[model samples]
Target chain A: MHISSTEVDYIALGASSDFRADGRHAFEFRDVIVESHLVPSVSGSSRAQVGGTDVLVYVKAELGPAQGKNGTEGVITFTAHYSSVTGLDNEVRTSNMLNAELEESLNRLFSEKQAANLERLCLLEGRVAWTLLVDVTVLKADGNVLDVASFAVRNALLSTLVPHVEVIRGEEGEADEIEVDDEPASRRLLLEGDPPVFISVCLLGSKWMLDASQDEEASMTSKLSVGVNSSGKVCGIVKAGEGALEWDGLGDTLKTAANMGVKIIEGLRKVQASRAETVGFFA
Target chain B: MGLREFDYGPLVSVERGTEVTTRERKRQWNELRPLFMRTRMVSHAAGSSYLEAENSKVICSVNGPLANTGGRTEAIERAKISCYISRTKFCGLEDDELEKRATTEYEGIVCRALESIVRVEQYPKSTIEVHVLVIEDDGSTLSAAITCACLALADAKIELRELMACCSVVNANGQLLLDPTLDEEKEASGSVLVSYLATSGKVSTVFQTGQLAYDEMAQAVELTISGAREIAVLVRNCLRQRESKDRGL
Candidate 1:
């Protein structure tokens, strides 16, 4: 999508005046609707819609041999795929770039933040463990896809049920037998507090705005994607766009993003708890 | 392929924290490793530089103001900046595929950082290519790549706002280690890389990973900026030295 010079100037002017095209304040976020446990086949699944952007996440757990020398912990990997109808005007190159960016961001968020305790997935030390494969699909792309994807991923992981594994000790040179219970009721993925969520803040002219729309993104100066958890801590940060940010504005942007991220996480948790029925894709 | 045919093993193994204690004893928490950098190392390229921060060694070369070959004819405004970063086989202890992926990710990061410093508007409808190769890697390769690329761009005589100086800080346990080594980086809970322009007191890029408190993040940024300032002085001195040599001083 291409915007004219007049459009960019108009967006900037409105942002500077604390007004947005969608009748939202500079710091206001679009209404986000989250639905979890929609896919029965997958271990966990969720869908998040932020305004026009829609994202689906599925978490699948597979039993595999433990990785690394200290193989007492499980592993989680993230991969993102862009559906053909998503965005970039169906350009393959840009879609591939976006896919790589989202995957890298998600992997870094989970691995570096240590949001979920992987020790809980370990069955036998240096032998067997659970490998969580998180696949994220962008059904629609308006804007703020990374933030929405993070939300869906966190919810999907939260709803994931790991089966209980019993390790029977061997007697006198016998191999230890591993047995996994296939019951539907299982333990939840142990998390360290609330998992971190990414909040992308765009610098529009002199003012910084949260949750920018696609039009706003096209006209924005720069963007900062900050990963913030419920405890008001930063997990990761990535800067995009060609524009430069002033030194004085960096601290303010980070602080505002952290505060907003915490609020969003709390709000989403409330929504998740209150959700009783599956809000399917069409509904 | 059979079920579970491929097992992508982890890069590093959990080790007893004993060796790290000894390593920490040798280097102060906030101390930086020795820095050795030189420009004009590659005669064939427009500009080139090699940077060695203790065990991490990086060579960067800058070429072009070449024609914009991206095929996007929609009225070019500023020159496009492109960066490619790769590591040699013997660079470090990482898998080949993983290293390639890492380099691809860093390509965007290094490109953006340079774009902020380079006066791209001066060369419209053109492209500037920066190629960085890691000859060796012990730790802090990303910071080394950025710093080296800046020197190469300057050597190429590209117009710029100010040279970018970058530094990395790793938060190990509760302590902040400046310019951490590979082992230290592996054991770190979080790390922050800041690319700064000391002249304008503005930061071009800030990439952070791992979990950190708000206060810790702020402190790390401040610390990284100061470290970058130190590197900026060294970079300036090196450039001055080159100028003196060219003038036969």
Candidate 2:
């Protein structure tokens, strides 16, 4: 097998206690820049740029019939598209994988039981329901796409609002009615309980690094990504790269990831609360 | 709803400008009087630029000189340049004929010019890819795309021994005009596209369609060469600005 000199250096760095070219600790993450209400025309939108990875997500709600099994409930469907700024050739495969992973992760988080509590979204019992479509796009891919994508999706969802609904009797029969006023009078999701965040750890040699760059990813032997809910629970886990991991290391990584996920959720909550008070895109 | 049709004219033609007609074409061109002629607009890439020839706006971004995934290791001295032109929504139908012609012409121009300027043998197994995304267009889009791609390549920190630029000249109503607009393009009798290297003052590529006299071709070449220089200067300025910004200067 052929490998570049950079790869060799990255492996050596991973083995040493003093890892990362930027001097960041193994558990440290790069600064994240998050912005909400980017697309004014859409119901809600948010963009997040973490390190070099960029993600934009928009939330739009439409009225549809509720499922027979899940009466008096609404639906939230998350669709993600990842496109790289670097060019189509380099990003096609990575984008597809990230999209599928993000969609699955979000679906797992917003279970039918949790969605039933959103009574304001349901128009009538087993009749009409509000379906929120969360569209996520990955414009630039430097590294850590999953984290950035999840951040944007969650932020967009937090910013989204579904209009008030009421049931009325018509001339023919009883009908479900939706009153969508210009004013922002809509219910917000209680995402504080079930919010999930993803943490990716790449094994350089014996040491694991958080938020690895594209070059570092190429050099690393294996990468373990863990999805943890707001309640410090491990929701999902996936391992990628060329090497295998020991059970002890995996267990330790999972514990570290859970702690990291909680920190992320706290940070997001702070941003969402403060951001909701603010008005304009640039401001 | 589908993509909306673009109206090139003013919202209120009588209030702002005269109506578009065959006889009023020259008058319209004379009135618009572009602020800048063939100026290089960007400067960060190995090559970067913008070609504002009349109403047409072309911005080019080039990135490479990093590595080549494929190619012979021994023949590393030469670099590979790929050109992509994003058509405007108004281009209407997406046809194979237009795409083939544009790609072939672009490949011919870039390949001929880079062959002489790039030290490809030094990096045998490597290639430099060039991508040109066109945000808007008025006329002679292909020629402008070639020029923009060259500038973007320069901005991307790629190594090129010389600067390459392209421009189009058309024959209109028995008179030759440099940088025709979309309206003029429809009525033009013939068109000549030329790509030139500023450092060597050499013509790398030339495509002339429709019948034109030898003297007419020479005149068009002369006009395009001078226009290329003006554009080269703009490209340099854009790069300088970006460099300064990057350095926090």
Candidate 3:
């Protein structure tokens, strides 16, 4: 839904009074719960629930030959799907749009060059590389699904452990291979350069609200979802609703989103650090 | 005059000497009224609402005022309207005979009611989609559906020339009951579904099933129109409340 221009003014005024319908301060973040290693069968999985929005992400990495012109190195790809249990209109289309946005953001965040630099992800040069598949599901939607999904994906990837591979040659020109280890070992991805996180902010009444509820979403004049990194860098942006934003408000919203993105990234890092041992689906 | 009552667990067998009592029926009707009333259910969608009458619960969501598909976009004279009804698992998740019949009946009522009030010529070929999801069922499912759909369209903030509303009437013994709940539905001899444009007091659509006298049909229609008017008043008040809140008055 598009936000109307008048609604934008209303929200701006409402923010000044600190009288949000959901009773939250303009900059206050919602309660977020993140659980990692939820899917045991998959290499890694995590679920994050923020308010009424629930997102689940599963990561599976396999060693295979890298495709395309750059065959000499390794590659990593991410795919996402959106499905709805409730029969809301345009659910499929909305899910598809979110999936495409996430895929593009992840690809841009972790390019082919970065994957090769990660070392552990690449196996036997161009012949074999680890292709990571990240599947995200939105079970219940209240608001701010993009942020919850991003957090789940990042934590799932952190909990993932790729198997070790070794290539050995026989004495008489016969090729041979040996198992280095059966147990999986912990590993970390090179995420310092681009830790993209998404923030969905809505313009209501006359103020821009961060993490709106379902009711607030209906009343919003316009909404802007911006993807940013730990360094306050924007990776992508999506705008919807019937409202217009002035240059000043847009700029302020972006700044607020960037700051919120950094806090989210820091929170995720702490979650990863606190885990002593991996928890599987049952746990 | 009393509440309508019927057993939802199992159908009772009636013998020559055993007949359903009027007092028992009124008792059931009184029990079901609260479930049929709902106010401002959906937060998203331009307009949204849900109502539970007896055992039936339906939620309606409206989305539109955006770009329409195809070459018809040029004929910006009137808006297009489309209605879809989905019955969820709580209302018996199986694809059975009763579900199909209920959907077909509700869809017809919605199409007719919306077409009557919507300015179809305004947007030429574009369409405004109205989706209704039935989450639970007790009885009078289709009537509840029509009411919910109209409320949703209103919630979506769509411009409607007139407000629409619907209700179901059932013939039990010699009397007609308004908004029959799930239990009353099981014992009802027949049912009539009706939708009305409240502003003009015009009957947009009507459907009846089972045997009924000619006078009964007229009475049922009258009851439905009156019930619809009551619902319309509630919807208007809710919208006004929301507007007042937005204006900070």
TM-score of chain A of each: 0.91, 0.82, 0.77
For TM-score, candidate 1 versus 3, the one ahead is: 1
For A114-232, candidate 3 gives per-residue lDDT tens digits of 22244445555556566777777777767677677877877777777655455665468765443444445434332333346677788766678788876567676566666666666
Q: Please provide, for model 2 over A89-125, each residue's C-alpha lDDT reduced to its tens digit, 9 standing for 90 to 100.
A: 4434453444555565455444323322445456777
Give lDDT for model 3. 0.62
Q: Report, to 2 decimal places, the DockQ of model 2.
A: 0.01
> Where's the lowest-lDDT run of ten residues in candidate 2 chain A?
A108-117
Q: Across residues B1-249, which tens digit of lDDT does each residue of candidate 1 receive?
A: 112222121121223344455454366666677787788777788888888876799999999878886656433778888888877888876784354365556788888889888998899899899999999888898999999999999989999898778999988888888888989988888889988886888787878898888888889878988888888887877787777766878
What 10-residue stretch in candidate 1 chain A is worst by lDDT?
A184-193
What are the runs in model 3 whose C-alpha is more than 4 Å off?
A1-16, A72-76, A86-120, A167-180, A185-194, A276-283, B1-249
By lDDT, who's the top model here?
A: 1
Q: What docking grade applies to model 1?
A: acceptable
Question: Interface RMSD values for the candidates, listed in order?
Answer: 1.8, 28.6, 26.2
Best by DockQ: 1
| TM-score of every prediction relative to native | 0.89, 0.48, 0.48
Q: Report the Cα lDDT for residue B222, model 2.
A: 69
